[model samples]
Target: MPAPHILSVFDQDMDRLQAQILSMGGLVEEAIRDAALALETRDDELAARVVEGDKKIDALEEDINTAVVRVLALRSPAAGDLRTVITVMKVAGDLERLGDYAKNLGKRVPILAQAHRVEGAAASIKRLAKSVRLMLKDALDGYARKDLDLVRDVLQRDVEVDQMTNALFREFLTHMMEDPRSITSCMHLLFISKNLERMGDHVTEICEQIIYLETGTRPEARPKGTSTAQVDVPYPGSRT
Candidate 1:
């Protein structure tokens, strides 16, 4: 049997668009992990590379924005195609910001690497960063699969990252109160962990957007770190 003409063309277009989005996602994720690894290993060269590589991310963002505009203007896609375009637009922007945060984290690695040690300040936050990375991976997989249940799961898992962030902050404050020498390093570590947590939240936001774009219905309970807007998009592929 022959594939339906409209669906086939739409699928081809979506394939290209999704490939670009996934490529950007992979780049940003690698940047984040590299920045963290650079810090952990005290590899100034790697840290410097991460900081400098942000330029490529910026260029890629411009290309993506241009491509999205071209699709919107030329194809005038409707229904789920429309939703996917909008979601990709918003998600790419969020990913760009995520890259910025990763770059910032790399910039601060020099300070943490100054003594070849992070002392006690990184203890809890390290765990938090690792968990956030895991969440990011799962959320991206969910987005690619368009598995609403999996995204719903990502929504619920966000609270764990939040709790860990809060706990780490409390512990950081305790260290600050206990010893003057710990204040500076603990403060920097605090910012680092906060950035990581925020990126995790942004990933969750992307997943929620995927849900809205794919289903035209926001979940009754939005996942953690996401507050959704209910727009009057017509349900795509729905029969009356």
Candidate 2:
């Protein structure tokens, strides 16, 4: 057992690390929201802001990584304490990827704004993004509260996100086939939908880490929605 003073310092370090992870999660959630709004309204300036905000999110991840290294090196945290430290690092990485996906969504806004708008595509993308954002929020809350039920909720919600993405994929395909001119816009929306779906995936990963942290055991196989592959549309930029 660590001495009383040493344990106090370790707890303080853990608190600081957890705080940084939550801050990063907050930035990521905002990025997802802003990117979705920019897409729906075709607001170029707001999209630019989402892209710019990614830098801060990236920096926070770096800070979290450094702090995690310091904790591992200096404290040599064991058992549950070590699990908590590792979970913080894993969550930070997932949050960074979420921010990157949001930035990608923002990057498409300018192109999407100029292209012929696919009917109802922007609204659909917004809905998808909103679902992902909520999942991320819940995942972070579960981690903070150490709530297993909340973690399970996030895992279950990911199936809904996949279903949403699949439906959007079909909708976009129909638009592209009917109006060839809309292909360009539909393609970009496809990318955006894929981004939001991937964000759900990352959020799910965070919840899994939370489960592992709390239980020292990984959760069961994740529930999955309909496979997008059934639709037979090649994902944009996918390798043959």
Candidate 3:
């Protein structure tokens, strides 16, 4: 094939791959949102739906991997396109693991989705959940638009989730130390918080991957005085 033909094929393939990644990311976001709602509303049915969405996410991951491998073999893409191929492969895996984390969150919903919820976890966990969901949403948007500043925003929100997780753990520990009854429920609460923290870590990884794709280099912390990295994150419901 001519170079232009190969390039055209590669472009089409990249578009398909991006679509697959976005689909997986969308499922992951839905799972996270529904899992939080399930716990808060004590709706076991919603939790079940989140679990099912997780299966679709897994399938999407498998399809993405297959698509990436096909492109790598056929296109042998070089330079910027090569970086994109590599970044996208890793990003897809990170997103898949993120889907698993969301599923884990859903699985735990039934435990806390009961008449008497664990003390100190309800409101705090809700806040943390919302923060993580927002981070995921922005992180995916950053990927689509190659938006570095938006990625930085997602990283900052990760710190917020981490801080909230620590606070919640401390509060839960203090309560359990005082009251023996909180042992089982507190452990469940810990599991949920830990998953949220790990999700934040994965979001950071995906953001870094997207950065690498755009810049052909691992992301270096931008010095304040130098020009800021130009990346556009598209947010649907807020001032741009």
Candidate 4:
């Protein structure tokens, strides 16, 4: 057992780590919300801001990584304390990926703004974005509060995000088939939808980490909706 003073230091370190994770989560949630609104409102400026804000998320992830390494080296946390530190690291990585997806959505906004409007597409995307944002928020809450019920709810909600993505995939395909000119815009929308779907996946990962931290084992695989695997268009800026 660690001395009382050492335990106090570990607790303080853990608290700081948790605070950083939550801060990163908050920034990612904002990015998703703002990216969706920018798409809906054709607000290029807001989208640009989302893109720029990704740097802060990346920096937070680095800080979390450094903190995790320090804790493991200094505290040599055992059992549950070890699990909590590991979970924090995993959650930070997930949030950073979520931020990247949101930034990808933001990157497409200006291109989408200039393209001819596809009726109802923006609204559908906003709905999809909103769903994933809620999932992310609940997942973070689950982690912070150690609420297994909230974690389970987040796991279930991932299916809804998948279903939404499938619907958007079909809609984009239909628009592309009906009007060849809409292909460019619809392709961008497809990428955005995929990004949102992937965001939900990362949020589910965070929830899974929370579950593992609380329990010794991971939960069974959750159910999924129709696969949107047919549309695998890569983001333009993504590395090969």
Candidate 1 C-alpha lDDT tens digits along 1-240: 344776687677778878878778887888888888877777788889989988888777888788889888867887777878888888888889888988998898888777334455554555666776667677778888877788778777778877666666666656665666777777777788788878878878877787888778875764343221211223335462
Please state the error at residue 121 of candidate 2 in Å: 0.9
> Candidate 3 has which clashing residue pairs, if any?
147-231, 147-232, 148-231
lDDT of 4: 0.92
Q: What local distance difference test score does each model get? A: 0.75, 0.90, 0.77, 0.92
Q: Which runs of model 3 end up more than 4 angstroms from their true locations? A: 114-116, 221-240
Which should have the higher lDDT, number 3 or number 4?
4
lDDT winner: 4
Q: What order do you get sorting by TM-score, best first? A: 2, 4, 3, 1
Q: State the lDDT of candidate 4 residue by residue for 106-172, as single tens digits.
A: 9999999999789999999999999999999998888888899999999999999998898889889
Query: How big is the positional error of residue 43 in model 1, measured in Å on the Cα after superposition?
Result: 1.9
**What RMSD does each model have against the real structure?**
11.4, 3.6, 10.1, 5.2
Candidate 3 residue lDDT tens string, 178-206: 66677777878878887887887888888
Expressed as tens digits, the lDDT of each residue in 107-207 for candidate 2 is 99999999997878888888899999999998888888888898899899999999999999988987887788999999888888887888898999999
lDDT (Cα, 0-100) at 32 in candidate 1 = 83
TM-score of each: 0.84, 0.95, 0.87, 0.94
Which candidate leads the pack in TM-score? 2
How big is the positional error of residue 131 in model 3, measured in Å on the Cα after superposition? 1.0
Tell me how far candidate 1 lies from the true structure as C-alpha RMSD in angstroms. Answer: 11.4
lDDT of 1 at 213: 81
Clashing pairs in 1: none
Clashing pairs in 4: none
